[model samples]
Target: MKVGIIGIGHMGQAIIDGLLNTMKSEELILSNHRINDAMTTYQEEHQIEVVTDNQSVINANPDFVIFTTPAPVTLAVMQEFKTLSAQTVILSAAAGISLAEINAILPEQPVALLMPNTPVAVNHGTLGVALNEYITDSEPIESFLQQLGDVFITSEREFGIFGTVTGCGPAFVDVFMAALGDAAVKNGLNRELAYQAAASMVKGSASLMQETNIAPDVLKDQVTTPGGSTIRGVVALEQHAFRAAVIDAVEASNG
Candidate 1:
């Protein structure tokens, strides 16, 4: 199936990277408001068609037309494509745009909302998807989404929290790792090695938690001896209100 993409921002690029493995280069068409050096390089490297105008993307007869424009620009882009056939499915990845808003403008068209993180570049992303009434069978879309990573079907209301946990969680984890890496450097470890080790530890710990189905607290307790350094570090985090800070971060993202 032909798929057209409008906008090539970070999320858009990540999605393109994931789709390239599942779809043929000739089946993909991309467009941006203005082509930059990066866009030119991406087009050359991927060998995908990059059209000059939005209309040309739709003219390509794509089954799926994905809009990865900024939230503020999403509605305008949809309005511009108002004449598109109802047979085409529209997918939006803008952060704050909702299905109701999309349907209000293009009432006959099927629309899908997706919030995917940057890790889609590595094909290990988490995507939160919400479909409108027009979409009857999700298997086709779900199959494509699975290629990116895990898929969580959720309501628009829950998408905010999903965005917080999966979309923004990576940055939070990076911040935590940077802190640990800083401490490691202070203790005489090479800065690059410290960062690499910290990332590996976090990745392995998360994998372990998922594979073993162990509660985080249980795992933490198992690793912490009565008077051990692990317990001391845990206590220090508690004293500094680390848990509360993370909760606040999620809440802030939701708002």
Candidate 2:
């Protein structure tokens, strides 16, 4: 299938990386408003065609066109292709844009909103997908998305919250991990080892949660014996309003 990508930014590049393993490079066409060294480097490394303008991408008449540009840019690009054939499926990775908004600009077009995190670069990220009524067969797109990570089909109303948790959660986890490393450093571990230990612990904890299908509180209780150091640390976190802070962070991201 002929696929066109409209930008080469971080998310755009990640999508390209994920697709290359599944789709033929020659069947893909990429175009950017401003082609930078990174885009040029990627083009040369992958030996894929990189056109100079959006019109070239539209002219290609690809079956699938992914708009990886910013929200404002996506709107502008849709306007530029307002007369695009209804047969093409339009997917956007812009966060604030909604399916209704896209349909307003291009009615009857198959529009889907995809929210993916940076970890998609490593093929283990979370993706939130919301398809419009115009999309009759989502299997092809969903199958391709599954190659990058777990894809959750949701309503447009739920897509933003999904992004808040999976997309913004990475930064929150990084901050918590940094604090863990700092505490280990205070306890005499070297900086590198401290970070490694903190990261590994979090990774294992997440895997354990998935494998055991246990609630976080239950897992916490399992790890904390009476008067144990773990319970003491948990008490300190509770005293500091850790849970409330994390909750507020997710809410803030949603806003």
lDDT of 2 by residue, 1-255 (tens): 788888788888888888787789887888888767877788899888788777776777888888888887788778887767778888899879888888999989998998988777778779989999998878987887787878989898888899899999999999998998898899899999999988899889988998899998999999899999999999999999999999999989889
- The TM-score obtained by model 1 is 0.93
Worst 10 residues of 2 by lDDT: 49-58
Per-prediction TM-score: 0.93, 0.90
- In model 2, how large is the Cα lDDT of residue 120? 78
Which stretches in model 2 have alpha-carbon errors above 4 Å? 45-47, 83-85
lDDT of each: 0.88, 0.86
Candidate 1 local Cα displacement, residue 104, angstroms: 1.3
For model 1, how does the per-residue alpha-carbon lDDT over 52-130 read when each residue is reduced to its tens digit? 6988877878888988999998898888888887888888999888899999999968899988998887788999889
True-structure Cα RMSD, model 2: 2.1
> Which candidate leads in lDDT?
1
lDDT of candidate model 1 versus the reference: 0.88
